[model samples]
Target: CDYELIKLRSVSLEALGENEPGASISRCNTLRCYPAKVPELIQNCCDYLEKNALQTVGLFRVGVSKKRLKELKDQVNLNRSLTFDVSTNAHDIAGLIKEFLRELPEPLLTRDLCSPFLNIPSS
Candidate 1:
């Protein structure tokens, strides 16, 4: 790997509201966000959906980094708002899914919609 991609696992965004917004995110499961591809890791952490259970969860940054100029100036996809598919806020993901699936009449409830396919280290 060119750069270190840290994975913070089992980080619950649903429980933690948008408190942090974009600054350093603290979750109930994992620790400091290293360089790992955090998005995929969070998805894999989710357990199988159970009946009448809150299987739908999303993660997002509680606070935004003060360094917002980097993304706009560098034109990079990395940013505090939401850099990867695994959001810092579960509601963010839910909204995204809901905009499409929110009203879907099918079995969207059971659907384990992964953010996106990424080649994360199988550690």
Candidate 2:
């Protein structure tokens, strides 16, 4: 399992290095940029979403471009090794988080939670 994880990591890292127009690398070294861990991205997103439930509806108002999605993923993975701060732009970060969630290859919320999630009493 460890070897597979390492292999996947290296493959992903290698993939990130490739550049394209408007890709994450293009934005790197610009706008208050730094690496961010996946969990940090998730937490930042959760915090923002929890506080501003209405934003979720607006999130889909603007169609997320591929460039933006790539940039968001890059930022999250890049910051994995660095110290986190709340200095990053919240609007952009929130959009990125929403896009990340939408683009996930698999559902983050597992089957176990589906029924409970739906059964939650609506306030």
TM-scores of the models, in the given order? 0.18, 0.38
Per-residue lDDT tens digits for candidate 2, residues 1-123, read: 121112223222222334334335523222222243233335556666576555455554555565645555555455542223564334555666565455544455758888999999999
| Candidate 1 TM-score, true structure as reference | 0.18
lDDT of 1 by residue, 48-74 (tens): 112222544333223333243222212
**Model 2 alpha-carbon drift over 4 Å, by segment:** 1-38, 45-57, 81-91, 103-108, 120-123
Error in Å for residue 98 of model 1: 0.4
User: What is the alpha-carbon lDDT for the whole of candidate 1?
Assistant: 0.30
Candidate closest to the true structure, highest lDDT = 2
Global lDDT of each candidate: 0.30, 0.45
Predicted candidate 1, C-alpha RMSD: 16.6
Error of 2 at 3 (Å): 18
Superposed Cα deviation of residue 96, candidate 1 (Å): 0.6
Clashing pairs in 2: 35-78, 35-79, 36-79, 36-80
Q: What TM value does model 2 have?
A: 0.38
RMSD to the hidden true structure, all candidates: 16.6, 12.1
